[model samples]
Target: MRRTLDRLYDGALWLAAVTFALIAALVLVQILGRLADRAARAMDLPPPGITIPSLAEFGAFLFAGAVFLGLAGTLQAGGHVRVKLLVRALPEAPARWLGAVVSAAAAALAGFATWSSALQALDSLRFNSVSYGVVPIPLAIPQGVMTLGLALLAVALVDSAVTLARGGTPAYRASEARTEADTEASTGESA
Candidate 1:
């Protein structure tokens, strides 16, 4: 189960990376197309008018998808900003409990977000909503991706809460510990 969950998070992260790469590739192509037109004009030839239809809209949608898809992976990787002063100050037992409580609360919020996003996706699907662009991209597609990302994030937070409640170090905490150890090793410090 643990391995499966880790793979799921990793897969989402990979997909997010691919999505961003696609965006970059598309932008590069668009830029190249513009340069081609410019070169043609400089040569006293007719311009090719090679412009990406609704490039801005496509970029925006892909950007949104990438951001949403990265949420769970970022949480698992300890990339999310957390105020750890209180947790670090407390005794081990109290700190564990506090972490569990906080994780649970965050999981609840993520769950709510997942629900709301799913609803929005469904509504868009029902209405057959499309973006106001040269290419009629379905609004539901991006909304559905957002919903999936929120669902994964909620699962990750719940996993953290459960692990903490069971007196185990959650993935994020373990990641942070590894990072701290690496930092200390490099600086010749011990804690």
Candidate 2:
């Protein structure tokens, strides 16, 4: 189960990366289309009419996918912003409790977002809603992707909270420890 969850998280992160790449590709195509049109017009020729339909809308949707899908991977990697100063100020026992509480709250919020997004997606699907743009896109598709990401993030937060409650280090803490160890090793080697 643990291995499966890890794989799922990894897959989500990979999907996010793919979405970002797609956004870049789409933007590039849009730029090239515009440049080609400009050159044709300059040459007193009929404009090639090259254009990426709904490029802005598509880019926006892809950007959102990248962000939402990356959340779980970022948390697991210890890349999410955290207030270390506050955590360090607390006693060890209190710190542990605080960490668990924060994780729980995050899980709750993520779960709510997941549920709401899923419902919205379902509603969109039921209504057969389509985005208004040069290229009509079914709204439910992107919403479903966002919901999946939120669900993955909620699972990660709950796992962290449970690990803390059991007096075990969370994935993010372990990740941080590994990073610090690597940094120290590199510094020692340099010295």
- Which candidate has the top score in TM-score? 1
TM-score of each: 0.96, 0.90
- Encode model 2's per-residue lDDT on 39-141: one tens digit a residue: 9999999888878898888998898888999999899999998888888899988898899999999999999999999999999999999899989999998
**Per-model RMSD to reference:** 1.9, 2.0
lDDT of each: 0.94, 0.92
Model 1 scores what on Cα lDDT? 0.94
Candidate 1, 112: how far from true, in Å?
Answer: 0.5
Candidate 2 TM-score over all chains jointly? 0.90
Q: What alpha-carbon RMSD in Å does predicted model 2 have with respect to the real structure?
A: 2.0
Runs in model 2 lying further than 4 Å from the true structure: 181-191
Q: Please report the TM-score between candidate 1 and the true structure.
A: 0.96
lDDT by residue for model 1 over 110-143, one digit each (tens)?
9999999999999999999999999999999999
